[model samples]
Target: MKTQVCIIGGGPSGLMLSQLLHLKGIDTVVLEKRSREYVLSRIRAGVLEHGFAELMREAQCGERMDREGEIHEGFYIAHDGVLDRVDLHKYSGGSSVVVYGQTELTRDLYEARDKMNGVVIHNAEDVTPHDLTSDKPYVTYRKGDEVIRIDCDFVIGADGFHGVSRKSIPRDAITEYEKVYPFGWLGVLSRTKPVSPELIYAKHPRGFALCSLRSQVLSRYYIQVPLTDTVEDWSDDAFWAELKRRLPEEVSARLETGPSIEKSIAPLRSFVAEPMRYGNLFLAGDAAHIVPPTGARGLNSAASDIYYLYHAMVDHYINGSDEGLENYSAKALARVWKAQRFSWWMTTLLHTFPDRIPYDQKLQQTDLEYLFSSEKALGSLAENYVGLPF
Candidate 1:
């Protein structure tokens, strides 16, 4: 089989890319290694930057999100036993973020793809791309005992960090930069009302915690933990108790505790791969870069990569211009580094490092105090939190 483009993933990035390309009269095929059920079961970040929302609208997939997602204009930060709010709308030129779960967004994209009769093969095994540098590029995978080959003019690797796409790049051609934090985030999803009207990021002597929500009725919360800790190490009661201990007394007093519907521990890290394109094969989304979720950039950043790639491919095919395609790497990486810097800065500003000495702690406190005291500092945080321009 042959097509204009072969997308090697069925996640939001690949699906959205396929949907956009279809609107441009471009034919594409998508491959997924996991079952559709497994793909939708994974939970992820919910915050959507304004540009992402607009993209969803363009894909004709934003009706559900616009109807159900919450618009958050600001968030709170608890430090030194007090709660302070950062006005995102005030600092972001009236821009606000939408709180829509990644699961729902993926579902919407899937529905849109189905309505358009887009081709997506699931449960593909041993997926691999070949002859990337050659004029002709093809991808192969197995279904049971049969081998299927798809020849295409372009291969898109939206399969994520663990997928074969990024790894397929020759080691010498890729320069990888990564920083793994010594701790992880312990997150819980429950059906209780959130403790605050908006998300609250708390910094205490014990650790850092965030109070967030997927909807008015579905609450999501997290607390920083050591790398050695596991979900089994903390029961529901223990997790609630610890979360309350770190929150401001007033907020804690109003907190409602309940059994967690889901609990997991996620390691935090910042990683980026240079030169997103390698000959006929291109990387997008998690396949190219990953940021810590502190600033809610993990998925939004992926959306930006898609934005650049979709436009680039369109320009090349329709306008007879190769400039966008040639510049995809430099353009995407420029935004990628800015987001990495923001996420790293937020993580350092809010999280307590176990290895920090007394002086370091004092410095952290001073930074927090300065942030709250200076309008300029708060404005900077708000601008980044609402997201930078694409």
Candidate 2:
């Protein structure tokens, strides 16, 4: 098979890029190592920066999102047994975030691809890119003992952190930066109604907890845990009891508890790979960078990457310009580092650091106190939370 672009991932980033490029009459093919069912089964963060929501509309995949997703103008930060709201709309100059599940968003992308009869190969094994430094690059994958090769103008590495995309690049060619936190988040997806109409981020002596909802009927919640903890270590009852202890008494009194539909423990980490381009191969999304879920920058950061790459591809193909492609790495990384800083700051501010010195804990408390006390501080937080411009 031959195409203009070969995207080595069927997640939102790769799928979104393919959809956008195809709309421009750019032929492309997508390869996924997992089945569609497996891809959609992974639970992820739901908060969408307004900019990301707009990209969905541009891709013609926002109808369901706009209809079903909730627009959150503000969220609460609970500390010292009280809840204080951060006015995202007021502080971000009227920008607000969309609360839509990644699963639903991925489904919409899949349906859109189906309508256009886009090519998305699932369960592709041993996918590899070759001749990346050359003008013509091709990707190969094994399917049922047969090797399939796709010749393309460009190869996109959106497969993910553990994916072969980044690993395919030579070690000396790419510089990696990473920081693994000492704790992880134990998240639960329950069918019960959410405790709050808006999301609540709680920081208590016990730990940090977040009360979020996919919809009014479906709730998603998380509590900070030691990295050593596992799903089997906490039953539904134990999880609920521990979560309640972290929340304020008033909020906990009205909180609804139920069996978790899904549960998983994800370790906190921040990572970025420099110069997202390796010859003709460009990286996007988790393949290039990742943030702790504290600020909801994981998928939104990928959206910015897709946005930059989409415009770059269009300029390269339709306008006969290589400027955007040439500057893609620097441009994307500029915004990426900002997100990393924000996520790191938020995580540091709220999470309990087992190894933190007493002075650091006091400083953390003071930081939260200053945030609520100062309008400028709140504005900064709101601006980052709503997302900075692309």
Candidate 3:
């Protein structure tokens, strides 16, 4: 098979890119290692930055999101038993985030792709990209016993962190930066009404806790835990107890409890691979960078990458310009670094480090106190939380 672009990975980023390019009359193909059912089954962050929400609309995949996704104008932050609200709508020039699960977003993108009859091959194995440094590039993968090769002008590595896309780049050419946290987030999804009207991020003397929701009736909550903790170690009752302890009294008083439908622990890490491009192979999303989930920037950052790459492709194909394509790495990394900064700062502010000295704790407390006391500090958090410009 031959195409203008071959996208390795059918996740939201790759699929979204393909759909956008398809609308522009650009021919492309998608390669996925997993079945469609498996991809849709994975649960992920639901918070959508303003720009990403707009991108979904532009992709013609926003009908369901617009109708069902909740719009959050503000979120609460609790420390020292005090709850403070960050007014994102007020501080962000009327911009707000949409709460729509990543799973649902992928479903919408997949539906649109099917309707358009876009080429997306599932269960593709041993995917590899060759001649990426040359003007002409191609991708190959095995499906069952047959080997399929796709010749394309460009290859997009959206296969994520563990995938082969980034690995394909020469080790000496890419500089990697990473910091793995000592703790993890133990989260539980339950079928119960959320305790608060908005999400609450609490930093208690014990640990950090987050109260988020998928819908009014579907509550998703998390609390910081030791890396040694396992899902088997946490029962529904014990998880609820721990969550309530970390939350403010008033907020915890209204909390509803139920059997957890889904439970898991996710480690926190901040990682970035410099120069998100090598030859005709461009990296997007998790394949290029990863942020700790504290700032909810993982998926949003990926959306920014999609924006840059899509415009670059359009410029190259339609306007006959190579500038966008040439500058893709430098431009994408500039924003990626800013996001990394924000996520790292937020993680430091909210999480309790092991062997943390008293002075550090005081500083963390002082920072929260300053944020609540100063409108400027709150504004900065609001602006970054809603998302910076694309």
Candidate 4:
């Protein structure tokens, strides 16, 4: 089968790109290795940036989200026994974030796309990228051991960090920028109620802790810990004790930690690959970059990648203009790098550093004090936290 764009991986970026292009009367095909149920159920980042919410509605994927998505006006930052809350809507000119998980967005997009007359081949095994310089670029994959080829004018890799597209670039010229932190986050979903009214980002002597909510019913929380610590090893008692210690005293007393089934221990990291595009193949979302979960950047960055690529693809097809595609890498990198820096900044400020000497800790404390004291510094943090529109 032939299409204008062949998108690999049925995650948010790939699915959303297919829907958007379909809306524009552009023909595209999506190939996913996993089942539809698996794609929609895997848990990931929530909290849609202001721009992302606008586009979701524009793309006609927001009907259910509008009904269920929790509205977050801002978040709180705590340090050195100091408390300050920046109302995000107050700064972003009334724009706000939606506390909806990435999995929900994927479900919305996939169902929306499937309902359209568009084509997506799930369980597509043996997929391979081919014929870059020709009139058609394609992927060869299998369906129950039957190999078939999908031909397209352009290809987009929205698979993720471990997918095939990132490896397609020549090893020598490919420059990978990365930083792996000493800590990891143990994220938990509890049947218990949230301790606070809004999200709390607290920096304690123990480590960083986050208190966020999925709804009035489900509470999502994360605690900084060593990457080696297994979720299995973290018994109910151990988890609550650690939480009680790291959480603010006010919330600590009230937090009703209860049974929870969904728990994940993800490694702390900040990584970005240069030139999201190489030849006829383009990379989007985690395929191009990753950020430490501290900033809640991964999902938003993925959305931003597709937003850039859609216009670039439109330009190529409509006006015979290669400029958009040619410059796609440069344009997308601007926002990606911004996020990389911001994610790194958030990670450094929130987490305790084992690498720091006594003098270094003092220096960091001095800087942290200045962050809360200086209006410019606080506003900068506010801007980064609320998000920068690309």
Candidate 5:
């Protein structure tokens, strides 16, 4: 097969880019290692930055999102037995975030692709890119013992952190930076009314707990646990008990509990790879960088990369300009590092670090105090939360 771009990974990043590029009359193909059902089953963060929502609309995939997704102007930070609010709209020049599940967003992208008869090959195996540095690059995948190859002008590595795209690059050519947190977040998805209309981020001596919602009736909650803890260690009753203990009394009093629809533990980590571009292969999303869910920057960061790549590809194909393509890495990295800092700061500020010294604890406490007291501090948080300009 021949195409203008070959995208690996049918996740949101890869699909969004394929859809966007195709709308501009560019041809592309998407390869996914997992079936569509398996991809939809994975529960992920639902918070969508303002910029991401706009991008979805630009891709003509935001109709359902705009109709069903909740727009949140503020969120609560629960500390000291009180729920303090961070006014995102007031602080970030009236900007707000949308509460839309990543799974649903991916579904929308998939449907959009299907409507246009876009090429998305699922259950592809042993997908590999060849001659990345050469003018002509191609990708191959195995399907039922038969190997099929796609010849394209460029390749996209959106498969994820463990994907073959980034790994295909020479180790010496890429610089990796990573920091693994000592704890993980055990999250539960329940079919119950959310405890709050807006999301609540709780910080207690017990640990950090978050109250989020995918919709009015589907609530997603998380609690900090040791890295060693697994799903088996926390029953529904036990998880609810620990979560209630962390929240303020009034908030917990109105909390609703039910059987968990899904449960998993995800360790906190921050990672980034230098020069997201390697010849014809451009890395986007988790294949290049990741941030802890604390600030909800993971998927939004990927959206920014797609935004840059889409315009860059357009410039190259239609306008005969290489400026956007020439500076994709440096521009994407600048915003990526800011997201890293925000995620790291939020994780440090709210999470109970078991090994933290007393001085560090005091500093954390002071940080929270200062955040609520100073409008400038709140403005900074709101700006990052709604997302910086793409």
Candidate 6:
């Protein structure tokens, strides 16, 4: 098999990238190690920036999102016994976020592709990219017991952080910056009434907690805890009780819940790798960088990736210009690093440390208090919350 570009992983990043390129007249194919059902069923983060919505429309993937997506003006930041509202729409040039899960986005894009005669393959035997600099790169894999090999011009590593694409690049060429936070977010989804109209980042003596929603009917929340803490230790009732204690009393009035359908603890961390492009394989999304969900950045960063890469590929194909491809790494890293800073800063201030400096504790509270008191500080936060000017 042969293609202009072979994308690994059928996740949001890869799928969206392929769709964008297809619209631009570039031919590409995506390979997924996971099944179609698995990809569609894995419920994850569900927020999209307003600018992201515009891009989605441009890529022809925003019909359902337009129909059902909830647009948020900004977020509520609660700390030190007070709540400070950040107005993102006013600050980020009429920008905010829409509530839509990554899984549903993928499913929607997949269906769109099928309607447009686009390719999204599941159970992709085995796909490999080796000896990247050659005219035809070696890609080998197995389907059941049948082995196959593919040759392609460029290989895209859209598979996630743990995939083989990263490993394919030799060591020492990679420079990484990372922080494994002392806590993880125990996320849960329920058929419950939402606690707030907007996303809330609330800090309590217990730890950091978030109140958000999937819809008017279902609510989502995250609680900070030790990386080693297991859900088994916190029964469903205990979880609700803790949330009630941490959230504002007014929240309790509307905090009704049905049986929990999704629950998992995701470790909080900030990670990035340099030189996203190595020879023939170009990495995107989680394959290139990871940001803690503190700032609601993981998926937005991935979407940013599709826009960047799609433009670069268009330049290469239509104008016979490789300038964009040559600068892909440096271009993506600028925004990638900023997100790292935001996530790291938010995590440090929100999560309590084992030996937290007394002064640090005081400073965090002081900053929180200052933001609520100063319109300027709150405005700055509002812009960043909607996402850094990406």
Over the stretch 61-81, how does candidate 4's per-residue lDDT look in tens digits?
A: 999889999888878877666
What is the alpha-carbon lDDT for the whole of candidate 5?
0.97
RMSD of candidates 1 onward, in order:
0.8, 0.5, 0.7, 1.5, 0.5, 1.5
Q: Could you give candidate 3's per-residue lDDT for residues 1-390 as a string of tens digits?
A: 999999999999999999999999999999999999999988899999999999999999999999999999999989888898899999878999999999999999999999999999999999999999999899999988999999999999999999999999999989999999999999999999999878999998788999999999999999999999999999999999999999989999999999999999999989999889999999999999999988999999999999999999999999999999999999999999999999999999999899899999999989988988888888888899998998
Report the number of backbone clashes for model 2.
Answer: 0
Instruction: Give the alpha carbon lDDT tens digit for every residue of 218-244 in model 1.
Output: 999999999999999999999999999
What is the lDDT of every predicted structure here?
Answer: 0.94, 0.96, 0.95, 0.83, 0.97, 0.81
* Better structure of 2 and 6 per TM-score: 2
lDDT winner between candidates 1 and 2: 2
Model 4 score (lDDT): 0.83
Clashing pairs in 3: none
Q: Write the per-residue lDDT of candidate 5 for residues 62-166, one digit (tens) a residue.
A: 999999999999999999899999999999999999999999999999999999999999999999999999999999999998999999999999999999999
Off by over 4 Å in 1: none
If both were scored by TM-score, which would come out higher, candidate 3 or candidate 4? 3
Write down the TM-score of every candidate.
0.99, 0.99, 0.99, 0.96, 0.99, 0.96
Off by over 4 Å in 4: none
lDDT of 4 at 241: 89
User: Which stretches of model 2 miss by more than 4 angstroms?
Assistant: none
Model 6: how far is 334 from its true place, Å?
Answer: 0.3
- Residue-wise C-alpha lDDT for candidate 2, range 137-245, written one tens digit per residue: 9999999999999999999999999999999899999999999999999999999999998999999888999999999999999999999999999999999999999
After TM-score superposition, the amount by which residue 334's alpha carbon in candidate 4 deviates from its true location, in angstroms, is 1.0
Q: Residue 43 CA error for candidate 6 (Å)?
A: 1.9
Query: What TM value does model 6 have?
Result: 0.96
